[model samples]
Every structure is written in structure tokens, then in C-alpha cells.
Target: MTVTETSATALHDDAVRTLEGWRTADAGQDRLRRDYLAHLAGHPDGLFRACLPAHITASALVVDPASGRVLLTLHPKVGIWLQMGGHCEPGDPDLAAAALREATEESGIPDLTLLTADGAPTPVMLDRHQVRCTGKDRPENTHLDVQYVALARPGAEALISEESLDLRWFGYDSLPELTDDSVRALVARARELTR
Candidate 1:
């Protein structure tokens, strides 16, 4: 009854197409895009295994349209304020669905939806960052993250999840100063997309 053999293949194919169709001028992102495409071509199970040298992750920046504020979760393992997202699960249909699912689960806002362009979920960003590995023999891992911007329903209540130390919204002009360049870049791109 393992779903990976079939569903995982479809999701991987969809992810490949999504990455191929994304438009970007950033050199680093372009590199990640190429690397992700290569990884998918090389590893049939790349979408599901965190133990792989590199794997696909889907995440999103959740913004409250009425207030112009973005929600961030204080990640317990990483110890930083970040967008709601994580590794793709078996039930996710595609990268965008995985991102939306992560946003809903992490932000506790089930009504969250992607900000679409021409009625399609346009990729807002791609990031590749090293993370401490969970595998028994691996010391580190890489995440090829497909990022998106999702709009949260106004007055939606956010409950702190087990994965987060805290959850809060910050105005665009008033984000915390300690976040890394990737988070800042994601927020900036998300703001531009919303505008």
C-alpha cells in the first residue's frame, strides 16, 4: 500500500515541469533551478527522501492582504523566524500544493491560498540551503526549495504548532533584523508579487 511508487513519480514529474517553467534572472536561483532539474533527472526518489544528497522542499510566505503583514514561524530547529513550509509529504499533489499544505499546517490558517498570476501559481522564488541531516550516516543535506506567496484570510487565527517556537506577523517595514538573506529575499519578492 505504499503510495510513493506511483504518487511520488507524478509529483516529481510535476515539480520538474514547474521548475522548468519558472522565470528567474538571479544567478544563484538559476543555478538552483538547474541543480534541481539535474537532481530529479539523476534520482528517481529525489522528491521524497531527506536522506538524499539534495531533495525538494516546498514553502510559502503567508501574507495578510488587509494588514500588509507577513506571518513567520520561529522554527525550533533552525531558531529563526521563517515562512511556514517544510518537506513534501505523500499526499501532496505538486510543489504548489505542498507549499499551500505547509502554510496551512504551520500557520493554522486553513483558508490560505496562493497569489496566482493568470490563474496559475507562479513561483515566487527558489532557494538552496544546507541543513543538518537526519540520516544516520549523513552529516548535512541540501534543500532545493520551491517558494510561493500565499494570502491569508483576514482575521484568521494562527495557533502555535509543535514545530514552531512562536508565530507572529510583522509589517514589511518592520521585520526582525536577525534573519538571513534568503528570508529577506523571499519577503521582498513576496511583497512585489502581492503589489
Candidate 2:
């Protein structure tokens, strides 16, 4: 394998190990975790967006516990408020790093701390949904998303990137009405962790 292929393979191995070790009280979360693992096993390119059947994506909810605010990006294509994340790049060292990088790049916030367990970054939830990876209309494939929580420093200013139509912080209790329940649920669970 070439250097790029080797790097991606390493990340794929890391993802399998991470998901295998993750546990949740929620049955649906655990079920999705298994499904993700199976997908990775069945398709070597499961972690890449180019995998058309489905792909393992990483995303993080940027939260400021002290202020009770969560940062969300209005997705340009979906035209709805969502977390900072996308397709896993070949260079991403691991799922958590992919989530962190996406959060930083999209939020323009620095020094965010990932919520962790057992001295390692752990997932807050799993959300599998259909999406058009590109801005084109209609569902293209599934995004089997491994969601994590990121703690943003208080009063961290957010700058919107081209990937987002708009980026803003909303109180945990007052997320945008247009925001879907999955994101709201993510914020609720993230609040529980930060507490």
C-alpha cells in the first residue's frame, strides 16, 4: 500500500478498536456501533466518504458548559443547523482526531478539549442518517456518525467557514427550532457529560 493508503488503514484499525470498546446504556447506540463495525469489516473503504453504500463519519458538538451554549453550523447543502463534521479524511489519525479537526476547522475555535473516558476520547452518541455528502439534492448515502462532545473555552469567538452557511451558539435550552431532534438529543447528552 502507498503511504496515504497505509495512513487510512491505520485509522480504520483505530476506529474498529474504538467502537468495539465503546459502551452505552442506550440499546440503539450500541446497535449502531455494531452496525458500524460490520460495515468497516465488510467494506475496507467504509471510513471514506467515497464508500457509496455507507461511511463512518465523525462529528463533535462544541459546548461551553459554564455558559450552557452549544455551537452549531447551518449546513450549506442540508440548510439546517447541525454539528461540525463531515467525511473522514485519509490523514485523520483517528475518529476523535477527525472530529476535533472538523470542529476546529468549522468553528474556528482553538484549544477545545474533548470529553474523554478512561484517558481516551469516547463517543457521546451514534447517529446514522441519510445525506447527500455533496451539496447536490437527494440522499446519496448513509452517514454512520460517531458523535463526541467537545468542550469549548468560555467566550470563545466562532468564525464561520465556507463549509457552513452560518455558525452560532445557542443556549442548551434554546436550540434553533429548525434543528432536528438528533442534534438536540446530542446536546442533551453532552450536557449530561459536562455536568
Candidate 3:
């Protein structure tokens, strides 16, 4: 294999192991985890391709430590407040790196750091959600999201990205009413993990 090909293969291997070994109390998440692993086993390009039946996504709950608030983006396409995340890029070594990169990029917080335990950032939640198919949209299928928690630098400012209509920080107890259950669950899991 060429160097790029080998690196991609190694990233796929890491994803397989990470998904296979993740533990979850939620039966739905557990099933999605299995389904994701199976999809990867069957499809060589499953990890990075957006048009797969279900593709792996990496996301992070960006929390401010001092105020215990979470940074959320108003996703234009989805039309909902959601965590910072997107499809896995070929340059991402693993899910955690992908999540961190997405959080930083989406929130425009360059100093955001993944909350780590035992010196390694860990996955805090797994989610599978359907996306409304826009004409010829890339991710017309479900998203199998591997979620992590990140901390923003104190007094950090957020710049809205073109992908989002707005970016704001919400208190843990007072998240926007339009926030979906999956994102709420992710926030709860993030709070638990970071604490």
C-alpha cells in the first residue's frame, strides 16, 4: 500500500477497534455501535464516505469549565441547535481527533481541549439519527455519531461558521427548547464524564 493508503487503513482499524470496544448502557446506542462496526466490515470506504447508508461522525460538546455552559451551533441544514461535529475526514487519525477538530473548527475556539481521563480522551456517547434528505444531499442516510466532550478556554469567543446560522453558549439547566433529545443526552453524558 502507498503511504496515504496505509495511513487510511490504519485509521479504519482504529475506528473498528474503538467502536467494537465502546460500552454503553443504552440498548439503542449498543445496537448502533454493532451496526456501525458491521457496516465498516462490509464497506471499505464506510469511515470517510458521506453517502454511505450510515457513516461514522465525530462530535464534541464544548463546555466552559468556569460557568458549566455548553457551546452549541444552530445548524442551518438541520435547523436545530446541535453539538459541533461532522463527517470523519481522511486526515483524522481516530474518532477523538475528529471530534476535537470539528469542535475547534465549528466553534472557532482554537484552544478547545478534549476532556481526558487516564491521559486519553474517551468517547462519552454514541448516537444514531436520521437526516432529512435534501435533493442529492451527501448524507441522506443515518449518522452514527461518536461523541466526546471538550473544554473551551476561559473567556473564549466564538465566531459563527458558514455551516451554522448562529453560535451560542447555553447553561446546562437552560438549553434551548428546540434542542433535540440526542443532543441533550450528549450534554448530560458530557457533564457526567467531565465531572
Candidate 4:
């Protein structure tokens, strides 16, 4: 199925309504969404345009399954705890798969399931900021995010990578103290979906 069709099938009514509001607010938002879908479908190199006003692209989100606790990476540049995801490289097919792959690579967790493919793409509030890339052949660019959840196996341990200063699990009820408002919003949305 196409990204638009998949998104229509996966998102809940309330989420769809929220998206509609976003669509109405900016005419370009709907076109951007469609363009992103087309880009993901056609680009062999896995590049997409940022929704934000920058020339860079690609991003994702990761979620823990058993306890509904999110494994956040404390980014050294931003110094904020956020999801485990980044640019979709030349190999990634879709955003959801890329998110899962990034989570596993960054967290050292092998058993990650793509929630979006299972008809449950968790809504995530976007965070757009400037940061230098830390990956191999590091390039400076903006990140256009495609965020989603991944169901990690129970009792899995996350091996933090060098990109992150710290890796920790934060309960939904107690997420405020650990991160910024955008991260908290992602956690809240995940909790809403799980419950």
C-alpha cells in the first residue's frame, strides 16, 4: 500500500482529525505530506524534503513495548532526551522501517517491531533544530522527521551509542522531569495509543 493509504488505514479518527487541522492550517502541509510519500516511494537513496524551512532531510522515532517506557537518547548537541532515530540512508524503503532499524542500531536492541506496519503508528510531535551529524562521514544538515513506535521485547537492555550521552527509560507518568515539551508530547501520545 502507498504511504497515504497506509496512513489513512493506520491513524485513529482523532489523529486524523488532528492531521486535518494541520492540513487546513497550511495548504503546503498536505502537499508536503504527499510529496514525502512520493519521495519515499521513488527515491532509491532514501532522501526526503524537510517539512521545516531547511534543505536537509530524514528522521524517525523509537518506543519500548512491555512497560510502554520510551528509550530516549540524550543528544549531546541539544542536551535533551529524545527518540532514537535519524536520516534514512540509501537502503531504507520506508520511514517506519527506518525508524525501527535506527532504534535497533542505536539502542542495541534486536527485537524491534514496526508499530506503523501493524496499523498503529504512534503520533509524535516534531522537533526541528540544527545539529551536526555524528554518523560516519558526518554531514551537517536539517532533519525532516518520520516518527513512529517500535515494540521492543520485554526486559531488553539498551546499549547506548556514542551519539547519546545517556540512555534511560522514563515512565509515561513521570516523563516531564526528564525531557522537553516535545518529548513529553510524544510520550503522552504513545501512552494514549497503548491505553
Candidate 5:
């Protein structure tokens, strides 16, 4: 059965199982992993962005394995270069699929391949950041981002989405100065996987 077709409850349960089984080498990441799991345990709507205060977000680092370049979106809201990804939809079947779906939509690049570990959509890394969407009464919210990597088809063209001010590819070693250390570390881990 397609579990995602059932209900939001299934999604939370699935997230719990996935996080519980994930193993990481980084001490900090392991702590974050536990935090993510705990968040899900406490918030049934944790996977959705509308969950106030904080929520889980899935993101993709679209990498061109043949060219050693990665796609980045200049986020219009945050005014920073970032990977393509955002809040999870109820239709998404799992975390990996959610990341892939977001990547495909934001990147507008077809035939991208999601790199997997042991045949699972295991995340390359996790990032937590604060965001405050513009407009009155929109308070600050925490984004618990689950970052994944995708192999962009060689020579694939990227189209900018409404969510970004610009979309461009940068060499792994040549990422723009506007990006934070989190993005740099994500690129580093993705590089190790691609190599």
C-alpha cells in the first residue's frame, strides 16, 4: 500500500521510523538527528511548514556529477544562495521523495537522480536555521532542514522558479560568498559521495 495516500499520521510515523534508523558519523549531526526524531515525536504536523515555531524541511543539492558543479538558488526571501528545497507536502511519500520532488520543482531540471545510501534516501546532512517570512504578524520560525543530494543529468538546463531571484550552477570549489558554512559543509559531504 502507498502509505502516504493514507493520512498525515502515516507521514509522521514514517518520519519517526526513518530517523530512528538513521546513523551518522558526525557528533553534531547525530545530535541533530535525535532532535529531528524528537520533534516528530512531539509534533504530529512536524513535517509540514504550517507547524508553527518550527518544522521539517526537505532540500536538495543538485549536483552535476560529470561537471563537478552544483545548482544553487538565490533565495528571494532570504537573499542568500541556497539549495532547492522547502516544506513537505502531504502527497509526498517519504523524506527522500519530498526532497526529490522539491528539487525537481525548484530546479526545473528533468531526469535528476537522487543519490542513495543502501538504497534509501538517507540525507547527506541536516541544517537548522531561522527564517521570518516577510509581512506583519509573521514571527520567526525554525526550519529543521533535511538536506539531500541529487545528480543532475549532464548538460541539464536549470530554470529559475518564483521562489528564487536567480538560479545558477557553481563549481564545488567556487561556491559564492553569499552562502553560509552550512551550505559549504553540505557541498563537501556531497562531494565525498559523488567521488
Candidate 6:
């Protein structure tokens, strides 16, 4: 389905309340807050809006089960190793679907499956971060983040997108050396949820 058509799923009330709290907490970023608010209003069940205090607008963590590794992208703007994800566009009906779309687009992995925290198709952790949304058009684009996790098989080849400078597979245990503390936390949380 088209991106806009896909992002129309309703969000839960708890998710809305969480998003509203973040908007109030980070009022300085008006444009970002407004855009996020608009996104939340559209999906009452999508909780990414509420869990955004962590520095993500939205995210998808792809794990490779065979190798016990995770697919990580070196974000061009943020300059860090992160999952394949971004803002929940108007067309992404829900966070899980959005994560899948991002995995396909960023990693060029076809038919990637999304798993839950419990190693099934379940909801994972919501990680947050702070980001300065740079570039020409988005002056007010600073981000408070919310992250999610998904699982894929090993040996899945990925085509790096412009958003990322590099893509690589890292063992879950060795991830600490390649990424920062926050990302490490995300990985740790994903591992816990998956375990």
C-alpha cells in the first residue's frame, strides 16, 4: 500500500497522552512538536508519539536471528549506528508497518518480518533521543525520539540508502564497541525483549 494510505491506523489513548506530555515537555521545538502532534492525532494506537522523549521521531531495529546480529545503519545526519527508521510519515498506518517499510527502504531487505519484544510479532521498547533536524527546509526540525525493534534472518543483504553512510552486521554482544551508550541501551532492551 501507499505510504499515506498505510499510516492511518488509530492510536491508543495512552499513546496520545504520552505524546501530549512530550509536546509539553519540549515546547521549545514548536515545529517538531506540532508535526508530531499531527502525527499522533492521526494514529490513536500508535504509541511512538508518546515515547519520543528519547531522541527518535520513529525507529526500527532489525535483528538477524541466524547470526545473532542486528542490521545497523550509520545515519548520515546523526552520524551514529542506528536502526533503519525515521519519522512516521502520514502514510505509515502504524509503527510496526512503518518499521517494516523503513527496513525495506534503508536496508534494501525484501519481505523483512517484524518481531515483538518477546521474539514474536509483539511491541518492543520505545527508545528516545534528542536530535537536531538539520538541512535547508527544516529549520524547526529538532527531534525527540521513539524507537522499536524487529527481527530478520541472518545473511539478509542490505543496500545502504542515502540516509546512511554505511550498513553492517554487528553481533549483539559486540555492539557496545560500535555504538554509543544510548544505542547500546536500545540493543540491550531489544535483546531482553527478544529473549
Best by TM-score: 2
Model 6 poorest ten-residue lDDT run: 47-56
The list of candidate 2 runs beyond 4 A from truth reads 134-139
Candidate that would win on lDDT: 2
lDDT of 3 by residue, 1-195 (tens): 887677677778988988877777888878878888988898766767544566778899999867778999998888899999988877788878999999999999898889875687878888888774433445368777888898987677898888899999998889998889999998888777666
Q: How much lDDT does each candidate structure score?
A: 0.85, 0.92, 0.83, 0.56, 0.88, 0.61
Count clashing pairs, candidate 4: 0
Using TM-score, rank the candidates from best to worst.
2, 5, 1, 3, 6, 4
Q: What is the C-alpha RMSD, rounded to one decimal, of candidate 3?
A: 2.0
**Which has the higher lDDT value, candidate number 2 or candidate number 6?**
2
What's the TM-score of every candidate structure?
Answer: 0.93, 0.97, 0.90, 0.64, 0.94, 0.67
Give a tens-digit lDDT track for model 5, residues 106-189: 999978878888887778899999898433368889999988998988888998888889999999999999999999999999
State the lDDT of candidate 2 residue by residue for 1-195, as single tens digits: 898999999999999999999999889888898999999999888999788868999999999999999999999888899999888999999999999999999999989879999999998899999888753754578999999998998888899889999999999999998789999899999998999
lDDT of 4 at 194: 53
Candidate 3: count the clashes. Answer: 0
Off by over 4 Å in 1: 133-138
lDDT digits (tens) for residues 1-195 of candidate 6: 554333433423333444444432334444555555565565443444333332235567887766778889988876778888776555555555666787789988886877642343433444435554545454343344445676676687777778788999888887735477767777776776566
**lDDT: worst 10-residue window of model 3:** 131-140
